[model samples]
Target: MKDGRHLVWILDDEWNSHELEKSMYNQHGFEVKVTRSDKLEDDMPLYAPCADGVVAQVGFQCRADVIDKLQSCKVISVSGAGYNHVDIEAATQKGIMVSNVPDYCAEEVSNHTLALILTVTRRLASYNRKVREGKWDPLDTMPIHRLSENTVGLLGFGRIARMVAAKLKPFGVRILVHDDFVTEETFNVHGVEPVSLNDLLQQSNILSLHVPLTTETNNLINYERLKMMPRGAFVINTCRGGVINEADLETAIKEGHISGAGLDVLEIEPPSPDHPLLKMDEVFITPHSSYLSEESIDELRTRTTQAVIDGVHGKHLPYALNQVKTETKI
Candidate 1:
């Protein structure tokens, strides 16, 4: 280490580190380097060799090849919760700790999920558009069911999903949760009914995904599973875009099988302007911003940087996703 200062690299063009956060790192004797690169593979060879730690953002793939080339990197800290883009197995083999900031935006994401559910159930967007076009009619939003009579299903009962359940309780909706890892006590505590995956899909009037994107969860919601839901069922996703098969969802909406969808993410971010889902009146899309709030962003940045600092100092990371035997000395 030059002058006993650890070298940390920030690899994301889209997000700039807060000045205060940088200053804190500097105060801790860290030499922070910020690099903006659209292509991670092309840039890693040049920068990874010098970096003692790295804080990666979404859209930057940290695959096995990149992890293999990290010469001095003792830790890789992900800015957000999901770390599917990073090859944890390879990093573990190389004795590099991988950490993620998982709880920073739980409230923001849960709030966004509730917002999507309300928008779809109330048909607010469609009505607003029609009214602006001089076609206002109360009957335009017919078949609106009372929330109390409908069932809202959660695909994963993690922290965000629990928050969503708590918020939806006031709406008087029946909540059904499907998660393999959660126990019966968790369901009882939340006052949510636990069900199998297939049962949740078949029974929910609106299904919301809260699972991470992984090998098992990628495209977890495919055509067959989409068809399992009752006709006219609505779908909502605030989790990883790859969890659902976009092509199949489009087909279900087009064939009038599924009523609508409220998505905060897509299989591809900033999808082509002419994408089929963009043209559908029943579809509501956000720019993968379900986890965004001023407070949440600040928390995410602070926690991520702190994790990197902890790793460099040989302290155990609180949000470590994988255990690694690091060779870096304290």
Candidate 2:
């Protein structure tokens, strides 16, 4: 602690200002240090040994080497839903709680997923480009199917995926979901049919992925899976990009098996200019901003700060992703 106040390190440098973080932590009788580093892992040595709590941004690596160096850190709170960046196993063994704010951006990401779904389903981009080029015919983008006739399938029935289902209910589309963790009653309550992964792929006219990236899910949507979908099927991914093999996806789209795609995240952020997907007019890529909105940003900051505050105060960390045998607390 610094000056008898708990010291929290904000290991995030992407944000424009730390005023919100400072004000929140300060009001709770905590001292906040803002660390800026292009390589947080390389600079972890300077902050880990003294930080009472650490707030790490999404995509920041908190590997075992860095996590083992944390001397006083009670908790490492990830500011986003995905905690794959952190070494949860190492933190657990070190008695440091690992938490994430999964629900903070549920509305924003679900809305973004819906937006991508509509963008590809309606062929909006194709028409806009045609209209801009002085073409007036709607037939410029042919083979557009009615949304009501499309069967939308969700790979995971998490908070965001459920919200996506709620939003799509009015559209008269049949929604199928596949999640091993979800119970049958939950699927019934949501009016969605739970199917095997194979059935989901074979039947969905529009497949939207929401599962986190893991060894089991990496490249889950490859060329073989793409072939299972009906011809001209559109793929949407607002979650982890590694879930789909970029190379296989390009090949499927090139072979005209998969129609088009709306991708908010890619296997690599700011993919190199020569990335094959960059040249595909059938693909729409966003800079992984699915969880962005002023409201969501404020909520994210508030919840992330709360986790640190709880940890520093010796309270159980909220939204904890892992269990620890002991937590270093005041």
Candidate 3:
């Protein structure tokens, strides 16, 4: 380490709680430097060459070009569960371990998913807008069904999806899950039914996505899959945006094939005002804020900093997403 301390660089655009992360890293004899993601390239030549580790958020893209520029970085720590923004293959090839704070926002995201389901199913947005605009007709939101009468399908039964299932169990809703990695026992223990992807898409009245973004999962919910869903089915995605084809979703909603959608993330963030989905009253969108809670943010920051500390100290990272040869010793 230079000057008896490890230097870690943080690339983020929205976070302002660096004091919390800085204090924790300082305790371990690490010096932290924070920079905005937009200015990372210019700042990299000045800071990255000497960085012992790097921390980044979803807004930052650490591709092969950026990865190739780091001269001494040993680990790339992501502040959230999804690390598709980081180039794992390039990091591994460069002997740089990549880690992520996966379990930090499980509760927050699952709660957000439930909120979206309730809003879309009850037509809460439509009712609220109509009531404010002097249209007080209960029939405006007709055909509202009880939660128990509908089936909810989960695309992937991971930590967050399991929490969603647990929260929804008391409502007596039939939950069907399709996850290749999970066994029938996993679903049985949660009081959920295990089903194939085709069955899940064909039978569910509400389909929620909770899978990571990968080659297999990218555009998993496409035109054909949307066609498989029963008419009037609602789609909710709190996971990565690329999992669902945005154009296909817009087409389905426009054609009245799919009833509505609740999306926390979109294929293109902060979509243009002219976007058709934004104009639809049947669609509800959040600005990728499903993983935010006071407690969760603190946990995410601490766990991410801890990963960098572990890497600098030559210790095993608890949430390492990639295996790399330990050649850079602090």
Candidate 4:
């Protein structure tokens, strides 16, 4: 590294756009070393030369064991929405602030949820399947339901959920939301009725998951909860994959307990092609990418990377995780 240069080592290979990062950091005259490897030990070969501090994507493990390898490391940056993979408690104890990019794609996620909902509602997947099978008139088997009379239940009333509801207003669908963080007044603002999970399950014609994954949220929709949803209602999960039990979802869909489902994320990414759910006709699965547009990816990269850069320079984090003070500063 050049003398008087601050080094920021990168552990994410795909984002190793060396030129983009190099040009961006050169303004500040920092040495940017990128070591791209799935295994932390493999980075040992380049550790002394490349890694002064680490900025990682999903591939890099920031666990205590791997983090111990850094020599002059001062900060760790995680580039994605979730920070569960990183041991934030350990980092904080060591006086390193952990940060994440938040709400960069709230619009994109809400738009994607609606696309999934509309695909199932309009029977687009079924139509596409029929054409591939040389069957022209697929609509002969089933009719699309009218959205005007349907009840759309949102599992959480976060910013994205609110956008979904707003866009759904043109359809004249009834909106019900269940988020413990939401206020009754907030629901009244959007004409959304607040309800219990059971009530939401029983009444919704289409349901969407929007909450973050946490201890309280893991497997939130298990067998019993799946059984609770109205038999004909469609379930849409764009939230974290583990939020819904995979086995139970397959069972529920196979038994005709629920009408259909649209899943953007799954328990294990790139689920086996032969997974029972894939064989079924009622489920629409995308390979865990509802936030893949260039715009969103750029925002996530810049914001997440900048958060760590700011922390290293002794500035407050751009979007910190759970570090809100009474003054409400980020």
Write the residue-wise lDDT of candidate 2 on 120-227 in tens digits: 878888888888998899876778898999999999999999999999999999999999999999999999999999999999999999999999999999999999
Candidate 4 stretches with Cα past 4 Å from truth are 1-4, 13-18, 44-53, 70-72, 322-330
Pick out the ten consecutive residues of candidate 4 with the lowest summed lDDT.
321-330
TM-scores vs. true structure, each candidate: 0.95, 0.96, 0.96, 0.89
Clashes of each: 0, 0, 0, 0
Q: Which of candidates 3 and 4 is the stronger one according to TM-score?
A: 3
In model 1, the Cα lDDT at residue 171 comes to: 90
Residue 121 accuracy (lDDT) in model 1: 80
In order, the Cα lDDT scores of the candidates are 0.87, 0.89, 0.89, 0.76
Report how far off residue 203 is in candidate 1 (Å): 0.6
Clashing pairs in 3: none
Q: Write the per-residue lDDT of candidate 3 for residues 89-180, one digit (tens) a residue.
A: 99899889999998999999999999999999999999999999999998978778898989999999999999999999898899999999
Ordered from best to worst TM-score, the candidate numbers read 3, 2, 1, 4
lDDT of 2 at 179: 100
Candidate 4, residues 91-157: lDDT per residue as tens digits?
6555555677658788888888999999988878888988889999955647578889899999999
